[model samples]
Target: MFFHQDASFEQLSIHRVGNKAQDEFYVLSEQPVPFADDEVLPGLLMQYFMSPFAKVNEVYRFMHPNEDLELNEVYHFTKKFFDGKMDFHSLSEQLAKHLYEVSSHPKIKGGELYVVHLKNVQMEGDSQEAIGIFKSENKETYLKVYPEQGGFQLDYEPEAININKLDKGCIIIKNEEEEGYQVLVVDQTNKSQEAIYWKDEFLKIKIRNDEFNQTGNYLKVVKNFVNEKLEESFEMEKADKIDLLNRSMNYFKEKETFDQEEFEEEVLGNPQAISLFKDYKSNFEDDFDAKFEASFDIADKAVKKMESAYKTVLKLDKNFHIYIHGKREYLEKGYDEEKGRNYYKLYFENES
Candidate 1:
């Protein structure tokens, strides 16, 4: 449902229970006798955690409220998400739907309530920074992030959403176009939240000097070229790999910018790129085992070519910077030990 820009907590309280900033208990006894103790509801869990939830591990405790809950539910839910059947978008929708189902239950009446802040907002720690929207229901609670001024009337009043330090309740909402997502810690009492982070299909690369007419086309070409090289179907000239890279760079300069939509169509329409991309994607494996293989292969080749290219093609200094894309575990935050490098690193020229 579309929320009003100025809707108050009182107006939305019917969908939830509990008062703002106060401990509101949801008595499972209100429901049927055999009601299961589903650990704690996600909405309440967020209040306890007080910090925004990032991933499953960060909020996994909610899957099983009590030891009595079957272990099978947790395992199956986790498998469904990690097994590649669901992505973030689909997961979020699923979570919302699940929450709606429970919220709509007869026993759940007026369970969702919020503590609204009019002007001044305060939290225990100074680091909490009453920053953005925070939300939760029965399944999970998370922070809602939006682009700068993308949506949400931040000027009026912002709420503190740090789940790590939350002692009291606070109403958080972003009433604007293109804004409305929640960050909450979920209690996986039986079902786990959906895993949907693997949906990013493209890794964007900036084209310096605005040389390429269609910005995305350069990416498409590079993507296609990479796939072809990976599958070993298309062979590069006998010349050094750096030479091939230089050729691609030069080709990018020659192509003029065209409409993004048209460029996408053209790139996708190309039978060679299409076939190569499909092959590359089909061959790609997101599991831990496949990630190591793919990343290692790319890194080994990219590093070698970079070393040669730094001295010859983009010649300037020995130091070269490089970036790579991989799964979160493959590429750690700040530093990636698996690759023995940081997310972005500087290599010195001619330095061993």
Candidate 2:
């Protein structure tokens, strides 16, 4: 996990970036932002920038398709700043200009951009310096209530930033310079055409192929094969599907490493089903540009994060919702001729 418990701001600069499509421009700050020697304001700003990254597990590295990393603007400027070849204020201006250039989408909003240099950030039990780039596009109105002359007075601030909701942010860690510096990003506001500019057009980052991603991607492929591809080739009941899902989850939970042959033999007893699943997995890898290892260490964090999506519920018409956890043989599906409907017979040894 990423943590900033002991992190402190070394320097911070804020600039305004406008949408280029609307013929707007950007304004750069002349110098770094100054704060008091105390920790109150710095602590608040730290929470604003770093709180959203606490549970972030996916890591990305800046990349250029042409194999020249200098072509990536963010990577270039960030490397210069980290190497002390460029100043903090100048780096912030350059980053703001780059962001404004990519803000060509008509629907994108203009906002204040904050660039901060942080020190002593704890990332996976390692201390590293990081550059935090955050943009606040949305403002909230907050009302202030205070006692004045034994009476409460109310005042409202129209343009206030909510610390809890960060619009767009990324932290460039200084650990991996040769591999694009281990960047973590957050874009909570825009998700449409405008969102592409933040991570794709501007940052130019690609996912790092690590154990976490491998585990997550493989689990997603398995889920898609069960939900989409299995029905095309075989006639399987809902209980059978749920059982497959349960067995998949249990294998990942119980085993440290994954083996394709073992998984096929244990979870998928049918040889034809295993062959079909292998073909579907190959297509999935080709379409998504992902490679899955036949044997790799399973990440527990990925499994826990993806557990919610692996549904085990069996819905019957409009009345009953049976949650099938395991033991598919215990549940039987049959057609009731008298009622002209389908029914399930559940077998159990004890009742709760």
Which numbered prediction scores highest in lDDT against the true structure? 2
- What lDDT tens digits, residue by residue, belong to model 1 across residues 1-352? 1112222121111123332224333322221112125445434443443332232111011122233322323222323443467442333333223333333223321233222212122221111111122233343345555457666532322333333543212222211102111112232221323211101100001111111112323334354455346337555422233334444443334444333334334434446755665455445422211211111111222223333332223222357432321111232225678986644323334744
Cα deviation in Å at residue 95, candidate 1?
11
lDDT (tens digit, per residue) of candidate 2 on 221-248 = 8888898889888998888888899999
Runs of candidate 1 exceeding 4 Å displacement: 1-133, 136-193, 197-221, 224-230, 235-352
Q: Rate the local accuracy (lDDT) of all candidates.
A: 0.30, 0.90
For model 2, which pairs clash? none
For model 2, the stretches where C-alpha displacement exceeds 4 angstroms are 36-38, 269-272
Q: How accurate is candidate 2 locally (lDDT)?
A: 0.90
Report model 1's TM-score to 2 decimal places.
0.24
